[model samples]
Target: MGRHSLPDQYGAGASDPRRRARRRTVAIATVLVLAVAGGTAAAVRGGLLSFGSSCQDDPVRLTLAASPDLAPALESAAKRAREADLTSDGRCVAVTVSAREPYKVTDTLLAGKDPGAEVWVPDSEVWLQRLTATGGTADVSTVGHVASTPVGVAMEPTVAKSLGWPEKTYGWLELAGAALRDNSLRLGAADPARSATGLLALTRLSTAAAGVEGGDTQAAAMMKALSQRISDSDGQVLDTLPRDSSGTEQGNPRRNQALVVSEQAAYAYNTAADGDRSLDFFYPKDGSPRLDYPYALLEQTGLTTDQSRAAIRFMSYLDDPPQRRLLERHGFRTSDDEVPDALVAGAGGSGPQPYAEPAARPASAVALQETLGVWTITVQSARITTVVDASASMSEPVPGSGRSRMDVTKAALQRALATFTAEDEIGLWDFSTKLDGAKDYRVLVPTERLGDRKGTGTQRDRLSAAFGDLAPVPNGATGLYDTTLAAYRAATGSYAEGKFNALVILTDGRNEDPGSVSRADLVAQLERLTNPERPVPLIMIAVGPDADREEANRIAEATGGSGHEVSDPSQIQSVILKAIVEAASRDGQG
Candidate 1:
């Protein structure tokens, strides 16, 4: 789709020929008036407009979509440019600036939908990175940066004091721990998938939780704990904070202590406060993500000669000294690293101290993609039934671990359980020849809330106990086909709403049951039963060197799921996490 082409939802009314003709007539009249005033000739003599460019009688019209937070400033600049009679080759340049969410635009572009904007000024370059990584059609080129804001935590003054604020150095882990330990400290962030600040916050929080070296189980648990507090937007998150006493309320039960937001947003909130209930900024010691408002030109939109020149001229106008100062008034630091003293003080920084910049560099494309995937799993609750193979081969000793395959697998399952939040539902099942009367699979625990149970400890304890109790049935054969079909049927029948439902099968051998249905029939049945709207990804983890990877992959493909093979049983937990992330990506949830 062309850059100017609106999505189907917006219809073709805006692109109607009559509308274009009207716009052209108005533009031509405006240019003629500007030329009569001598502004066009003076600008041309000043070398502001390229001499060789087309000199159409009509002014060029360009559309610019900017992040909501930055749109107001950009619109002001665009208006000023039009009033100043900014032109390319004597033809006046007019720009229309509109507010748009970077994530939504990126999604639309990646889906092969037209964004209807010649330029995009997103809050950060992250959106551009994501677009390129996801195979967007737009050939984007960054013209320059307009403003910058770093991601930081906004806390009520009293809360900051309690946490040792400016006097103490804290990173993401410390902040996350405080929230998890104190029930009253309700930490909130925007949905990571849609907000750059939220996404950066999550990336930092997850990295901190996992530790620099990765695979920190306790940290992963903390990350999941943090996800439960996510809000829909920065504004909604700020609303949870306490307001000043001019009849304004402070934070209530749902929102209390801290929020993840951009530095500019925090400044805006503090400046609007009527009392001492202002929010203080806390830049993470480890590093924060900085949002550099990048001005990108959509080159693939097939811009007309006049439109292209108009876009260039307007971009130059926005970067002028006067326009930069205007942007500073709106709480953004200029591209030249210039921040006003008054703005700094308003955001809670004093004379000798300035708001801290991001300590860590921006994430690589691959890292950002992985972080988003992990965030999806953290937010979307899952209903999973773990089916373990307890056939005779499970008792064989693993090569390097010096432990039986079953023993290692059980240990990995126990570790994996810790990564899930309480909101997630899980169950346990075991499969072997004739395990339940003539059946190959039997339920060890019924699916229920991770935090729900009849007895003292949580459901996790019950699951761990079940895994520990699994023992290989001597002389038993693998009942892969029938057990898988039955499990899939059970999962589909009991599918929960607003949750990812799946049956995770871990096996060390191929199907060996003669009484089972044929492999082709099983694949066909699974394909026929699959539903895109109500998806239940069948994840098959082939364990040990002897496992059949090909058959496992076949089953997963038929059900819109995934398959993974692990030769080292000790790596099972990590592999399981990877599988879950991959499944989430396949379902387009991340």
Candidate 2:
């Protein structure tokens, strides 16, 4: 059978007619759910998911972890489900909810521990993408988005009025410029590494600013400016806003007058703060990215058949009209088209604000990576040792890129180098079988501050020249294992205490040096070299079709890093940044 299923649901299996109809429109992201029943879908077709007609067979109890902000609303909906005695095939469906930060939860799951939940309702699919991006396949499946809210800049009414908020619409860059140019305007945001809201806004700002003159420089400047007032998380960033709507506290360096936040957050804050302590919102004319709370089933939770079916049953209950109202009352929109007038007003949006307009398309996984990379580098800086494969295979032409892998890889690396500031420390290495004296790797540039003067110019200048000089050594075979081990040792041995220390290796082929150390030995050495007190993440990028992703994954994972596969070298820059941000977030350094 060219198919997979949980015993029954397709071909020989059946499904609930009502459920099939309702779930047809559910937002399916990465996972497809097949309802499981003991040997037959008939029992599931009935209101009970094959459980006996008793409420006390331990009732299919499921635990869920939800994004902090969305947790309360989900709890309310779950409470209603329990009160209504919602059941899966006559068994009671009991779901317990807990609030958890998305980044922390993702890190927890990636570390291969029980996240203490069978279901996860993250604030956005972006977090889910991060999981799938690095791990190749995430062990989670999305049923539907329970609720949504657009991300926008929220400001005090007085400050918003001064900028012509209600009547005048602004693009992301225009609004960002306003915040930067006005001395009285203090703009803040959540650290992009931790908050999808902050990352999306920053990504949009980068897009908007790139269309203008001096884009790279301008974008870098904007990132630096925004980083000055970044908070650790969404909740922390909100706390930076003035306590009152009067805008008097906006003058204080500590209180931000404007912030990157979600519409629902603005609504909730306004409703609770009331009178003079309310906020106004500016939905960018271009489009506001949104937080779509996706109901994800954590597949690795060891859930029983009954438990899995019961989780789906609860998700179905959330889709009902009553639960939709519960989400809205908690300051959210069930769908983009059904904007509530009172909710919009309460969220500090009014006529001409584009509040009812359709949401902007979510940024691609690559875009999110680039945005986060920029934020991490600009704010925290880094010490990176980039190792490139100078193996003969790198000379092969990429299918659609019209350039050899080596050519494109070098260009991408240089582009990535440009995003770093002079304060950052960077180095370069090239490897191939028997490159020098039977050694697989040779350091072309020692890791040093980019701004530090060397011979006739700075270290950055020297490194750029070194990158351009790289070429596939004549008939050089890949020496991946030995090169990786040597680089890992170098990176961790010199871990810069105050900076993000990392080793980034870009390879186009698997280990071709039979004489090199065994894969098991290489991984063992890397594990021994890795230390939390002196953290150094190994970011391995396998380029082109010939690169070995599984090998890369095995070796990189030993050092608390990840292996990524790119079809072409053009994606190298974005991938590098993404890897760094992932490492930082895992360390809770965001």
Among these predicted structures, which one has the highest TM-score?
A: 2
> Per-residue lDDT of 1-590 in model 2, one digit per residue for the tens?
00112222211101245554553445231112434323346535764342433454556788899998888988898777666556676566778899999988887777777889999988899889988876734488887777889999998777899999899999898899899875679899998878889988988988887677756556776787888999989988878877765556667888888999999998888888867878899999998998988878888888778777777777767766787888889898987567999899989999889999988988998888888888787888789999999998889998987989999998998888877887789999999988879899999999999989967899989999999999999899999999999888888878887888899999988999999999999988999998988789899999999888998888898998989999989989988888887788777642
Assess every candidate by TM-score: 0.71, 0.80
TM-score, predicted candidate 2 vs. hidden true structure: 0.80
Query: Which 10-residue window of candidate 2 scores lowest in summed lDDT?
Result: 1-10
Please give the lDDT score at residue 370 for candidate 1. 56
Q: Residue by residue across 286-328, what tens digits does model 1's lDDT show?
A: 8877788887888777777667666766666665678878887
**Candidate 1: where is the Cα deviation over 4 Å?**
1-57, 87-92, 129-144, 212-229, 255-257, 272-277, 299-317, 335-340, 351-354, 364-380, 386-416, 427-483, 505-520, 531-534, 539-590
lDDT of the candidates, in the order given: 0.76, 0.83
